[model samples]
Target chain A: GESVGLHLPTLSVQEGDNSIINCAYSNSASDYFIWYKQESGKGPQFIIDIRSNMDKRQGQRVTVLLNKTVKHLSLQIAATQPGDSAVYFCAETRMSGGGADGLTFGKGTHLIIQP
Target chain B: DAMVIQNPRYQVTQFGKPVTLSCSQTLNHNVMYWYQQKSSQAPKLLFHYYDKDFNNEADTPDNFQSRRPNTSFCFLDIRSPGLGDAAMYLCATSRGGLAGPRGFFGPGTRLTVL
Candidate 1:
């Protein structure tokens, strides 16, 4: 992934309603993508992941959709709650950047769950 | 339960002093990563160790370093802490390099430079 500036976009949703966070990745060859949720004063927690071979993967109330054709990814959360308010980041790993290195993260999207 | 643990949940160090943050995992994963995140910023990869092999990010400053003595332990060493270096240090581990489940992250060590 190409280096990006520090600014990030934000999405606000009402509590008990569904929320959708979107991301646009730079690398088309990225084969693996993961979504992470980082709450206040905590490390980024893994939410879900999707491989390039597949278009969508679901886990619990979270679903990751990958659109390789547009080099885009989105995470949909069901029944957003106050606990879901946090910074969400999407990371991508490609076979090209070297061998099995760590992921390259996006600028992140702040998910605000409003009551 | 399988989880990642980080020691010294809070650290305070004087400018130019050396500081180390520790991380350990019970999942027995082979890969470990260290990241630095400022307030409201994305976690930036500083470096990682695949077993004993150390891989550093190209843009990572010379002031930062890391060590993974074994499969479950990894450490981040700041040779000379600066005010700008003060941030939350996160440690993560994964079962495999790629095509693996979401990597597990430690609770993070919040570092404050005096």
Candidate 2:
């Protein structure tokens, strides 16, 4: 069966350095992708999104690159900070016969910033 | 201003007991969504309200039910929670603009079913 990453969660990054988080999708039809940052004891917050028509999208100090050829996605954060420490998740959505299909989420990456 | 608010940040309930999670959004968005996230996992969509129309995920269990009485408030009701029902419940809202509009999410409610 098609699936996403089934691996460890923890990722440690030095402050002021770049951090990259990766995700993979099982569905080939997914057209919209989103990255969310979830701090401890909080819900996931929207960070950035990229459409299927485009290969990459950038925001504030973050960039999301999509490789549709491999069904892979990555989120890059510049100058990692303690405030940026959190769990990051990537989700994908596509239109189906049942209205707008809900998003399918990757497991998650726990980003730890070392000051 | 906080766009979304969820009540009772932490809830503890006994098995087979009914539980209700409440969410309110000030964004006045036309779409509201509910997601269930277990420990160490990603948020899973339970259902959402596009305007007044409700849509439930096909894999969502029958024990979970959602109600969107208006544009601002959405509720998730667990008819009879089991130990496995313990998880974080998140509520999100988005303006019905296009398919990729960013969604605003509220601090989640952590449920513990014993």
Candidate 3:
């Protein structure tokens, strides 16, 4: 089955440095992608999203880069902070006709910040 | 603030016992979704309701069922829970169509089977 997957299961970065998380998706028909952050004992919180039509999108200190040709996506966070420690997941889904469908999430990458 | 709310953040049930988890949303979205997530894994979609129409996943188990009696409330019922069924159940809501649709998730309910 077509699925989204992450390149790394865990990442360790020092505070005040930049961090990057990578994801790859096999579904070419997917038109929308989102990045979510989940803290321990909490549900995922929306961070940013990018549509297939666009190549990149930025929000605050985070930037999402989408490469449709290679079916790859990456999230970069500048000046990583302690609060940035959490599990990050990338989800993809294609719109069904005029309605919507559930998102398919990747395995997720655990980002650990070193103080 | 308008958001999705799930009740009983933690629930404990015995094996083969029936349990129900509740979800409510103040966003008044047209679609509600139920997902199950185990430790160190991604969330798996079980089913969703678009308005009054119910859409179930092909691989969803028969022991799992959902009910949405109104626009604001939805429930997930597990008929015969087993040890493997212990996981975090998340409820999310979204407005239908292709206008930048995004799911708003609740805190989730952690179910434990004894």
Best by DockQ: 3
Candidate 2 residues B1-114, lDDT tens each?
Answer: 857999889999999999999999998887888989998888888988888888887888999998988888999999999999999999888775454445678999999988
In the predicted model 3, the residue pairs found to clash are none
In model 1, what is chain B's TM-score? 0.95
DockQ of candidate model 1: 0.55
Q: How well is candidate 3 docked (DockQ)?
A: 0.71
Cα displacement (Å) at residue B33, model 3: 0.3
Count of backbone clashes for each model?
0, 0, 0
Q: How well does candidate 2 score on lDDT at residue B29? A: 82
Could you tell me the lDDT of residue A5 within candidate 1?
26
Residue-by-residue lDDT tens digits, candidate 1, A62-88: 999988887888899999989999988
DockQ of each: 0.55, 0.51, 0.71
Give the per-residue lDDT digits (tens) of candidate 1, residues B35-75: 89987778888988877878899999999999888898999
> In order, what are the TM-scores of chain A for the candidates?
0.89, 0.90, 0.97
Q: Give candidate 3 misplaced runs (Cα > 4 Å).
A: A97-99
